[model samples]
Target: MGRGPSIEGRKNAADAQKAKKFTKFIREITIAARVGGGDPIANPRLRLAIDKALTANMTKDTIERALKRGTGEGATEQVVEIRYEGYGPGGVAVMVDCMTDNPTRTVADVRAAFSRNGGNLGTSGSVAFQFTKTGEIIFDIRETPALEEKIMEVALEAGADDVLSEDGFIDVLTSPDSYLGVKAAFEKAGLAPIDSDVVMRPATRAALDGEAAAQMNKLIARLEELDDVQDVHHNADLPA
Candidate 1:
């Protein structure tokens, strides 16, 4: 018998999502290499980008090509980083980080996504004050005092700001500058984080439910669907 249609559709969607993620990683790597250098040891930003790509299962050859493109060997266009701030449904603060070769096209797409989804794009710094930029490292481990103590001991010793146990994960927060050192420390100690990133964490969350929560989710999905949108940060407290 043939596979279920729903299963096949899910597989296709997953594949598409993975491809999009790879494209974003490549762009980030190329930009990082271009701004800094191809040597990961010498360039912290590029090093982090490459690490993320590797963790995502990006192939070595693909990474090398991105590095070469960044180094201008086969690069076609210059990509620039642009941040768009806005308010989504339920007064939730939203920030969109993008790397694009064309600012005009990116901005238009971003604005349209916001407007069509019950949102309004705002000027720079408008909603930025609502967030704090920090490095977050999350470990998927059962909550235990012993493990929590171990994580705190290692992370704090490595300049981490704080450690928190949330839901089914342990979160280590760090200053942006201390992120690389802290991560290295964890790795050296044989503690591998399931996910880590420098992100704009919302200082406050806007709780929403029913229609507002649904609208907020839709807005975020729309924003993330944009090819130029690399990351979407929001302060919405919706149901999981």
Candidate 2:
């Protein structure tokens, strides 16, 4: 008989997963701080970046060093945030978010990926019009309804478009201009959400067949392997 699902094995697997995720956390923090500033107190984005680092178990020294680079205390490079729009296989529209010190090299790599992966690199704003910017916040269920109630009221008061109650979480959507106010409202209510960021939501979606989904996923994976690539959003919907 073969041994199945050993406990020690599962623990080791979890640890490895955590370590890999921690590396990505540090990278993002470093990049975020480098572009913005090290002081999280004054930089809301840096504060969010630090929160992510803490959640991923990044060490204090690592976080500090990243901050130092941001403030010019350490050897640093200018990392500009850029977004690429493309059409992936099956004519699926995709957008790639990147932070890079070298735009020339990054664009060349991104264009190549699109060409080799059965897609074409699109002109700026080509796919942008297909999406709308929204301030989306993902938070856990608080212990009491007071926090939830306050969040909804404050978000709506601040011009949020909608408030949703998912299975075990709450999502608040706001106009891009009202995002900061809504986020501040959540903080004022003492709810530290897991993540909050600006994202692109599609105006209309184009469905992909199973084969197209697989191809698109492969293309997306290839984009993720690039060091500069941060986030990839696509109109293709994947099965849950």
Candidate 3:
């Protein structure tokens, strides 16, 4: 499947966002390789991580450098991958995925963001129980006949759990075990998706509106401003 066409309305904002997002993607690759080894052939997670960077238009030079850093063949600096759990405003559960050279500084920055936003950072496993980590892949939605059928067949054949076409893309859910397989199959079929990541899936979602939603959105914005914060996942229903 191919993207139908670019949406002029959001292209500028998306371009701006991709600049920072690509940085995070690179960080993720570096850390993923560090923890799991630099060879994507031997590391499934790293393979997926690289695919994510590519999806965001990360250049090959940038990615190879990250891998070299991870493997210690190019750099000796320490880069760590850390996950933080917290409660945001309105009792919304949040999972922050981070990459940093200094965990101490990272923690302080995260704590301050939470405090200033009326949220509380919890212990290692405190808020994690509220959500499950799942593989989520999105395809750039296209206008074509037999669209859903095409996506469903590819996803299911590769062990996807479900397929939902909404928000202009087909979202394929899979157990982490099959993520790379599904991704590879789709790539071979010439369907490039927008994004894929291990996301926090809340068991139940809380609906937010009016001032509460506004506050939550603000909190998210502030959290993202922190460079250490790579990906922030929440289970609140709010409109973009």
Candidate 4:
């Protein structure tokens, strides 16, 4: 009894999503360069950001402009990183990371999203203690099972904290300080990851279903739609 999108509608939606992703990628590249300097050789974060942007088909000219902006050349507004903590539907702890030129507007927008979604914003550190920051490298498992053992051995030998295989991928967890080294080791072993990033992992998860699950999904989607929001993390386990 649900209406589906027409072919044209689907194409339009796909285009919009791609545009949104490109915008976010640009923001990330700018921030990383700003914080760590414009030279990717000296800045691992910026290097990672640039790699992702390139993978997304961002033009070289666009990437150079973003780097210039970060280094205060041809810069207009100053952007700052901010983190907002809150609880979403079903009491799920949520954290929103944003890069914005205006903190007041960003906070107001985030608060509005939370309040409208049956949630309330929390004070700093209210929920941050329940999370840990770590480096995560994910590899697609397209080869034989023997590949898993090799990945685990190389990752751990190179300072990885843990290696987990699931959902057709292998995840290598490492301390933030050891991330680069572990990644290099994987590459040396001819095991390139499909994705790699530093992220905050939740210590616990909240199980939600039915109306609560639907509401949580809506809340996350709305938050992501905001231009300034870069990443949204939560400790909710919704039914697949």
lDDT of 2 at 166: 68
**lDDT-sorted candidate list, best first:** 1, 4, 3, 2
Q: For model 3, what is the alpha-carbon lDDT of residue 86?
A: 85
Per-candidate local distance difference test: 0.90, 0.79, 0.82, 0.88
For model 3, the stretches where C-alpha displacement exceeds 4 angstroms are 1-19, 139-145, 165-170, 190-194
lDDT of 2 by residue, 1-240 (tens): 898878999999898867656656666777767666777766767776776677567888988887787777888777778999999987888999887879999999999888887889998888988888888988777565556777677778777899988666789998765677778777886768778877887777777767777777778988887877877887877654
Which stretches of model 1 miss by more than 4 angstroms? Answer: 1-9, 140-145, 166-168
Q: How close is every model to the real structure, measured as TM-score? A: 0.90, 0.71, 0.82, 0.86
Model 1, residue pairs in steric clash: none
Task: Rank by TM-score, highest first.
Answer: 1, 4, 3, 2
Note each model's CA RMSD in angstroms.
2.4, 4.4, 6.1, 2.8
lDDT of 1 by residue, 103-197 (tens): 99999999999898888999999999999989999998774546767888999899999998877689999997789899989999998888899
Q: Could you tell me which residue pairs clash in candidate 4?
A: none
Write down the worst ten-residue block by lDDT for model 2. Answer: 19-28
For model 4, residues 1-240, the per-residue Cα lDDT tens digits are 998999999999999988988888888888887789999888988887887788789899988988887878857467889999999987899999998989999999999999988788999888888889989999888666668888999998998999988977899999976787898898898887888877888888999999989889989988999999999989999999
* Residue 146 accuracy (lDDT) in model 3: 54
In lDDT terms, how accurate is model 4? 0.88
